[model samples]
Target: MSKFDDLPEARRRGLEKMEEVYGFDMSDGEGDFFRYTADHLFGDIWQRPGLSDRDRRLLLIGLLAGQGAADVLGIQVPAAHANGELDDDALREIVVFLSHYAGWPNGARLNSIVEETIAKARRS
Candidate 1:
């Protein structure tokens, strides 16, 4: 009965992948942005076989951090941890490594987000 039930196979797979990656039901999302996110980003890109989800997540973390995308990182960092893709130590190391290339300010922001995400997980 989900909206994705009637979608094309690729779209359905994409939505399912989004749920798996984000660890939540995403079938209620709507609109073009949602469609592209599920269908293209998740379906076509994330589904590609060249890299594991963990690999992709690591690359994405660097890209997002370099772009100073704290809001998106807020979602991605926790999801990465919850999915067992990145542990607290690995996350902390990324902050140190990317600081040189992505700039100290962006690295500082990443550090904050990483610590907050780890602390929240510990409290749960």
Candidate 2:
């Protein structure tokens, strides 16, 4: 079996999805960061065995929005949609809900990224 076969189901799915969503190529120059993302984030942490990927995606959106990480949102928002982890209404609700806790500015930035990513996804 491949190393990928050794990964837990959630981690394997998350890893494949991350590559598809982020266009991550571990062979690229950013090997260290990609490796950590693969080994720690997806391989270990995402395998914790409780919430589903949809639940995790929701939390990730909240964290990214709260931290003003719109750029990362550019990737994650569409990925959530593509993978069936989020729908349009759920995405909108997330923005509205997080606006209070994350602040309007961060929410606005995330909202913009969400729209742009959704549009891009539709076009392609």
Candidate 3:
């Protein structure tokens, strides 16, 4: 019924980290969308027909850059790093990649977040 049900505990732990550390607040939803997304989006969907985790990470980084979601980028950049989704160079690549579509300011902001995230992750 939910992807969480089938997900490995490690990945589920990642989900919990995202929710707790990032304040995802899944409880606000009425449907099982949270579980569904966790399972499907992060678990099955990610493992199935969608792009590779690295690509998804790239997509997320780029999308976040486009929206100038510096906060989410700050969080996800480290999470994405923890998951081995992108190396520092690769992460930088995504931020650079975004400059073409999103503009310099958004890319600049995301670059700052990425740098801070990488630094913090290195400490932890």
Candidate 4:
């Protein structure tokens, strides 16, 4: 059977939200990390109504940049663009603005990832 076949409502919702946010199916994910990700992070935190998805994306982008989390940002940046939460110009502006606060080095890394992702998106 599939991992998600009999999941609780919250986890099920979380998986669906994960797919929506990341622009890919997450139903195949397994293990403790994936469970918590779906059950808490996506299910509870992401489901909060106070922030729009765009607002959350912006916050997450800044946090990820500040943390120098290029790998996660590699996923988030493209998903944000694909989900209409951020366009090319907005993504570029984020790199430019965050570079000041997040530090030039992290900003440089973000710039590279954003540029590469945008280019790849355009070519597809």
Go through the candidates in order and give each one's C-alpha lDDT: 0.91, 0.74, 0.68, 0.91
State residue 44's C-alpha deviation in candidate 2, in Å: 1.6
Compose the digit string of candidate 4's lDDT tens values, residues 17-75: 89889998776467999888999999899999899989998999999999999999999
Model 2 pairs whose backbones collide: none
Model 3 has a clash total of 1
| Residue-by-residue lDDT tens digits, candidate 1, 44-93 | 99999899999999999999999999999998899999999999999999
Which residue pairs collide in model 1, if any?
none
Give the residue spans of candidate 1 off by over 4 A: 1-3
lDDT, candidate 3, 1-124, per-residue tens:
4344455764564464445333444322234766566645554555555566567667777788888888778777877776766778887887788877999999899888778877877888
Clash number for every model?
A: 0, 0, 1, 0
Per-residue lDDT of 107 in model 1: 99
Which regions in candidate 2 have their CA more than 4 angstroms from the true location? 1-17, 20-31
My TM-score estimates for the predictions, one after another, are: 0.91, 0.75, 0.65, 0.92
lDDT of 1 at 2: 55
- The TM-score that candidate 4 achieves is 0.92
Worst 10 residues of 1 by lDDT: 21-30
Error of 2 at 93 (Å): 1.1
Which pairs of residues have clashing backbones in candidate 3?
3-39
